[model samples]
Target: MTKIECILRPGKLEDVKDSLNKYGIHGMTVTQVIGCGLQKGRKEVYRGTEYSINLLPKVKLEIVTKDEDVDEVVKIISQAARSGEIGDGKIFTYKIDNAIRIRTGETGEAAI
Candidate 1:
């Protein structure tokens, strides 16, 4: 099993979600987040005052899937989130040791 986490510009969430659905990925966790990496955020002026916004709003998606689905999921998210500009965001994947469904008491692949 694997856990895929993607952080992208918030505006791309709907598109990414729709793509995931079209790809037959039904379950995921979505979170609104603030982060910075190479983009390092930006500067905005208000009332003639310049302010540096170090934390940019981003949409985070957490999906757990069988190992075979990792690459496809990543591809779907990358394609949907890309904008040919900076602050486009990033994706990370981790091996999942275990998973359980509380109501059904299912474990491993069945749980997910």
Candidate 2:
């Protein structure tokens, strides 16, 4: 199994989720996060005072799938999250040793 983690712009969440659903990959965990990368954050002005916001809001999606589906899943996420600009975020994959569904007591691929 493989675990795919995607960090994307908050505005792109719905697009990514819809794309994944169309591809039949539905189970996932979504989280609101703060991070900084190549975009290096941004500057803001509040009450006439300028400030640097180094950490930006982001949306994180975690999905676990069979190993063979990794490539397609990554492609779907990439296409959906891209904006032709910096801070588009990143995607990462990790090998999953095992998975267990607590309620059903299912394991391996079945558990996912």
Candidate 3:
């Protein structure tokens, strides 16, 4: 199994989710996160005081899928999240040793 983690702009969440659903990928975990990368965040002025907002809001999407489906899933997410600009976010994948569905007691791919 493969676990795919995607960090994307908050505004792109709906697009990503809808694209994945069209591909029959319905199960996922979504989280609001704060992070900084190549974009390096930006500067803000509050009441004439300047400050660096180094951490920006982001949306983290986590999905566990069968090994063979990894490529397609990544492609779907990439296409949906792209904005042709910096701070578009990133995607990471990890090999999952096993997965278990607590309620049904299912394991491996079945569990996902």
lDDT of 1 by residue, 1-112 (tens): 9999999889999999999999999999999899888887589999999999998889899999999989988999999999989889899999999999999999999999
**Model 2 spans > 4 angstroms off:** none
lDDT of 2 by residue, 1-112 (tens): 9999999999999999999999998899999999999988689999999999999999999999999999999999999999999999999999999999999999999999
How many backbone collisions does model 2 have? 0
**How many steric clashes does model 1 contain?**
0
> lDDT by residue for model 3 over 12-67, one digit each (tens)?
99999999999999999999999999888689999999999999999999999999
Error of 2 at 48 (Å): 2.1
Which prediction has more favorable TM-score, 1 or 2?
Answer: 2
lDDT-best of 2 and 3? 3
Off by over 4 Å in 1: none
The regions of model 3 sitting more than 4 angstroms off are none
Predicted model with the maximum lDDT: 3
